[model samples]
Each structure stands twice: as structure tokens, then as C-alpha cells.
Target: MFDPQTQDQPLPQRLTRTLIIGAVVILVAIGGFTLIRDQFTEEEPPPPEPSAAPSPQATAQPTAPAGGDNLAQVDDWFPHSRTEFAEAGGVAADFAADVATIDYTRDDWDSHAERLGQWATDPYAVTLTTADGVAEGIWRALANDADAWTGSADVVEVTYFDPTSVTIVVQVQAEPDTGEDPTDLGEFSVDLTTNEGPGWRVDRAELLR
Candidate 1:
């Protein structure tokens, strides 16, 4: 459908007008196709942000045991194995309990001292058996009173430690047969020598009260 006036134009002019209209039509069609594609085609999801790296967890520190000879509680035992530490702690605890407990009615102080001697050095053993020694004094005093007492000990902690020595603090509880409240003998600091004399023997012991 050509216009009569357009038909009458010169051949070059008519050709130019026809070409321009075709170009406009093509441009319009291309724009419409782009709009339709944008409407139907889902936009790709934005790239997921990389997750933050997990934070490093903190390392846990070693903790001391509440009581008993837990070998794991021994941190430093240079020149000695953990077995030695456990043995030393056990010997101190036993000595503390026995020394603080007495039964005057049974007349067993000699036997008790004999047992304790196994854990002491020769000189200390003599001290325990001597008439004027601390053990004898304790035995006589309790026997005179005719009172029986029992004791128990808990290894509170190791206060000092070295290559050949360690100091342990024990909590002693002495209860009398009269049924009164148990007496707290306070903390006993028992110093022991590992390399000298017997393997882990008490060198000296004193109350820290």
C-alpha cells in the first residue's frame, strides 16, 4: 500500500524512505523482544557470600584434683615419673591419717608405729619409737584420757616441688569416740625426699594451722 504521492517521488528518494521505515521497524521489534525476555527470564541469584571461617577454639588448661592421688594432677616431676608423684602423695596421706588417729582401748600403738616405720627413714623410725618422741607422747596422752579417736586425710594439693623433693598439704579430720564434732587438725605440710633414703620418704612434717 503505497501512497499515490509517494509513488510519484523520484526513485532514489522513495528507496531511501522505504529503507528508513524498515530500519525503524527492526529496532522496535528488537526492543520488544528484549523486554519480553527480561520479564520471563529469572535473574540469576547473586553469588552466595562465602561463609566466614570458623574461629579457633581455645585450649583447655590442666586442673588440679579435688582430693585423692590423681596422677594427672601432677604437672612437674622432673627427674621422676608420675608414678613417683602418686606414690609420694599416697604415703603422705597415709602417714597423716595414721598419726592423727589413735585407739587407746586396743593398745595397738606399737603395731601402728611399726606400720608407719615402713614409710620412714631409719632415723625417723627411731624417733617414732623413742619414749620421748612425738608418737609416744601422743599415745600416752590419749591412753590416759581413755579416749579413742579415728582419722582420715584428703590430699588437698602439692605446694612445692623439685627434682628430688615435693611438699604436700593434707587435710586431716580426727573424730573422737565421744561423738563430738570431728577436730580439724588443719593443713599438714609434709615434705618428702624422693632420691634420698627410701623412695619418697617423709623428711619432715608440720601443721600449717
Candidate 2:
């Protein structure tokens, strides 16, 4: 029994079906949009902080020793001169003057001998047994000659020096006993030792040709 009137639904039923279909399509569109938006979006990371520079106070610095630069000041361990005779120049000058001031005619040979004795020591002292010995030798040599003889010694240089001792090189010039011209005795090297009591004294002498 198919009837043309029944085939055409009622208006209220058609309206309800239409409203339900439209609601389903809207829900589907909203779900798909939410999924797509979530897939494309991302959480951003935090920015990096700047590094700090080194400060002058953080650097290592060199410092001097506790004694306040020990190398800059001289220590007591080093030897020092306490007397004038310990000085090389003064001792050398005195020795040269004594050697050149000998006069055979001067009756005061004792004074010359005493001065020489004061300057000489050990081996040189043995060379001149007594102050008179030096005078006698020179007197014997100048007895026959009447010419005025003069002797002079020039300190050429100080070869070596220390707190205890010094060596000097000297050039000696003397007028001949024959009244001839002065002659050079070449150079002489003398070693002297320092004494606490007597100061500096000659221990050895050598004629360096």
C-alpha cells in the first residue's frame, strides 16, 4: 500500500532532521581546526644571558719577598772596607811613595828603613833584614858615584783587589848613579795583605819585564 501522501514527510520531522545534520557538521569543523592549530603552534625557548668580563682584581700579580726586595740591598755577608789602608788606591799610593823616596846621603836611613819595614811583610821583610840593611846596600852602590840620584815610582794600575788583599802594578824611574839620564825599571807587580792592626803591607814583589 504505497501512498503518494505518505512519501512526503511531515514538516516538523523534516525540520528536526535538518537541524541535527547542521549541528554535526559544525562540531566536525571545530574539532579539525583545533587539531591543525595545535600541530602548527610551538613554545618559544628563553633567550641566553650575556657573559661577564674579567676584572682587574681577579688577575694574579707578582709580589716581592718579605724583606722588601732583598736583591736591591747589599747584605752583611759581603766584605766591606773598615779602614783607609784597606782601600786599594790608598795602599798603592803609599807603597809607591815609599819606594821612590830613598836618599843614600840622608843620614836618617833608619827613618827610610822604618817606613819600608812598615810597608813590607813576610818575604819582602826577609829581603830587607833590617832598616839599616836597605840603607847599607844603597850607600855601598852610591859611594863611588857623586851624582845626585833620584828615584820615582808611578802606580800604573791596580791589578787585583779584595777586602783582605790587593795587587798593584807600578813603573819605576831612577836617575843613574853615573849622573846619566833617568832610566825606566820597567814595571813591577806587588801583592799586599791587609792587617787589622798595621793596615795594608806588602807580602811579595815581582819585576815584570
Candidate 3:
């Protein structure tokens, strides 16, 4: 038969069980505190810093002016064709006459020199004569020695015509009173410009060959 008093656990065994229960309670409390701390804690945010604004865009530069060879602009400036052609032809004929016609006498030479001056631009006129006297020094020397010389020009064509300018090509012939064959002066090109005044004036003259 079992005794009721003896069925009770021993003192040492009861102390061991109490210690195990206390350890389990301590572990549960530590876990719950850790979870609560994590849930409530907040992280710090970074402070803002100042930034520079974008620089303003630079402006574009202007273009430079073109020097000479403004033919396109010149063409636009004068629109009339028939009038320009007539005026240019007349000017070219008068200039050719002035250049080819020279007399042995001083009076006739002076008149022709004056006409030539009127038919050329200031720059070219300077070439025909200086402030000292009429005609270049070399031409004056020839005219001084010669008894008689005559010349004429036949305008072959007026080409590269523009309102302000044109190219005059002509065949010039000359003869002396010494009774020699009429010399073929060959073809010459005269570039005339109307920029000086109302009438076309010679800017430059050159031999083609």
C-alpha cells in the first residue's frame, strides 16, 4: 500500500524545478523588452545643405563684314537693264575715243587729255596726268619727239555688263604721218565703273595679249 506523505516530491527536486521556472520567466521578459524597444525607437534624418543655381547661358557673337567682291549686292542695287545698257555703252564709246584720239599739236593734246581725265575715276585719272602737267612723263616724252601720230578704237564687245560696271573690249589701230602700215594695237580690256558719278568711268585698262 502507498503512503500519501511519501508520494510528495523531495525538497532538492522541488528546488531544481523552481529554478527552471524562474529561468524561463527571465528569458520571456528579456525577449518582450527587446521587441518593445525596437518598435518604439526612431532613426535620425540628415540635415539639408545649400546648392548653387545654374549659371546663365552666354549670348552668341555677331558676324564680321565682308570686304570687297560685293557683286551680288551691286547687282541688287541696280535693277534696270535697258537703261543701264544704253548708258554703259555710251560711256564706253566716249572713253575709247578719248584714249585713242591724240593730236600732234599742244592744243589738241591738251583737249584730249582733259576729255580722258573726265572719262576716268580719280584713281585712274591720276595715272594719265599729275598735278604738274598733262599726260604721264613717258607719254609726254614720246609726244614731244613725234611730229604726228593718230589712233582710233573700234569697240568689239561690251561684256560682263552690270549696272555699276562693265568690261569693254576693243581693237585699237594706230598710224603715224611717216607713212607706215596701220599698226594693230591688238585687243584691250577696259574695266569701267559708274560708282564715281552719273556716267561710267574707266577704273583700269589692260592689254589682253
TM-score for all models, in order of appearance: 0.53, 0.45, 0.48
Position 59, candidate 3: lDDT: 78
Candidate 3 residue pairs that clash: none
In terms of lDDT, the poorest run of 10 residues in model 1 is 137-146
Off by over 4 Å in 2: 1-87, 107-114, 130-148, 176-180, 196-198
Q: CA lDDT of 27 in candidate 1?
A: 100
TM-score attained by model 3:
0.48
lDDT of each residue in 111-149, candidate 2, tens digit only:
665666677775666565453343344435544554445
All candidates' lDDT scores?
A: 0.77, 0.63, 0.66
Which candidate, 2 or 3, would have the higher TM-score against the true structure?
Answer: 3
lDDT of 3: 0.66
Query: Taking the tens digit of each residue's C-alpha lDDT, what string does model 1 give over 33-118?
Result: 99999988979899999999999999898786565475655554365577877888998998888886887666587886776676
Residue 171, model 2: lDDT of: 78
| Candidate 3 lDDT trough over 10 residues, lowest sum | 131-140
Give stretches of model 3 more than 4 Å off: 1-80, 107-113, 130-146, 178-180
